[model samples]
Target: MGVLFYGSAEHAIEIDDVALAHLKVVIATKLRRNESFTLSWMHDSGQPLGRSTIWLHPSIELRFAFEEPTPPPLDPAKIQAYANSANTSGGILVPEEHILGSSRGVVLTA
Candidate 1:
C-alpha cells in the first residue's frame, strides 16, 4: 500500500502502490500546468458507506509514499483513463479497488 499525504501531514489516504503510481503521473501533469481539480473515491470498508472528494492544487503540500522502494511499472491505459477523468469538470474518481486489477471500470464525470 502507498500513502497519499495531502495538505495536513496527518491526512493520508492509503492506495494501492500501482494505482498511486498511475495517479501520480496524471496529477503531476495537471499541477505542472497549474491546473486544480478534484479527486473522488468510494470509502473503504469499515468506513462510512459513502464517497469522498478532495481538491488538488499545485500550492498544496502533496506527498506519495510507497511501501516498496521501487515503483511498479505504470500502465498507459490506466494513466490515460485517469488523465481523461482529471480533465473533466468532476476530475478523477478512483475505484475502491486497484485500477490495474479492478473490474469497476473507469468512470468520467462531467
Candidate 2:
C-alpha cells in the first residue's frame, strides 16, 4: 500500500511536483536569508503506525498544513480493501483515502 502525506492544518502547502519545486525555491531563498520551519506527515496505516518528523530552516517556520479544503470523506469499501491488504507490502498501491494526497512513498500496488 502507498502512504500519503498531508499537512496537519487547513491551507498547508501540498507537496506535489509543482509545489515541491516551489518548496525548493522557497527553501533556497529562505535559507539564503537564514530561516527555519517544520514539515511532518502521518503514514496511511490509519493508526499511530509510523514515524513522523519535522524539518526547519533558519528563516522559514514551515507549519505543516492541509492543502485540501477538507479531507475527503472516508469510504467503507476502501477501508475493507485496506484491511484485506494490510499485511502485504512492496510496489505502488495507493488506497482510496490517498487519491488526492502526495504520491510519494508508494511501494506496494494491488
Candidate 3:
C-alpha cells in the first residue's frame, strides 16, 4: 500500500503503489503547466460512504509514499490512460483494477 499525503500529512489518502506512480506522472504534468483540476475517487475504506474530490493545484503540497523502498516499473499504456483521464473534464479517477492488476512481466520491488 502507498499513501498520497495531500495538503497535509493528516490528509493522507491510501492507494496502491502502481496507481500512485501513474498518478504522480499525470499530476506532475498538469501541475507543471499550472493546470488545476478536480480529482475524485471512491474511499478504499468506505468511511466516507461515497466519494471524495480534491482540488489539485500547483501551489498545493502533495506526497507519494510507497510501502516498498523502491518504486515499481510503470506501464506506458496505463500511464496514457490515466493521463487522458486527468486531461478530461472529469479529471483523474484512479483506476483500481489497473493499479492492482497482474504485473505480467513488470517486476515490483520490495
Model 2: residues with Cα > 4 Å off, grouped in runs:
1-15, 44-51, 58-110
Q: Write the per-residue lDDT of candidate 1 for residues 22-97, one digit (tens) a residue.
A: 8899999999999999999875544545677899999999998887899798889889999999999999988555
Instruction: Report the C-alpha lDDT of model 2 over 1-110, residue by residue, as the tens digit.
Output: 21223334333333333233333444444446664444334443433456344444453344423334544444455444433332233211233344233344422222
Ranking by TM-score: 1, 3, 2
The local lDDT score (0 to 100) that residue 12 gets in candidate 1 is 72
Worst 10 residues of 2 by lDDT: 85-94
* Candidate 1 vs 2: which has more TM-score: 1
Give the Cα error of residue 85 in candidate 2, in Å.
35
Full-model lDDT for every candidate: 0.78, 0.37, 0.70
> How do the residues 1-110 of candidate 3 rate in per-residue lDDT, one tens digit apiece?
77777896455666667777878888888999999998776544335345677899888888878887887898888789878888899998764443322222211211
Q: Report model 2's TM-score to 2 decimal places.
A: 0.32
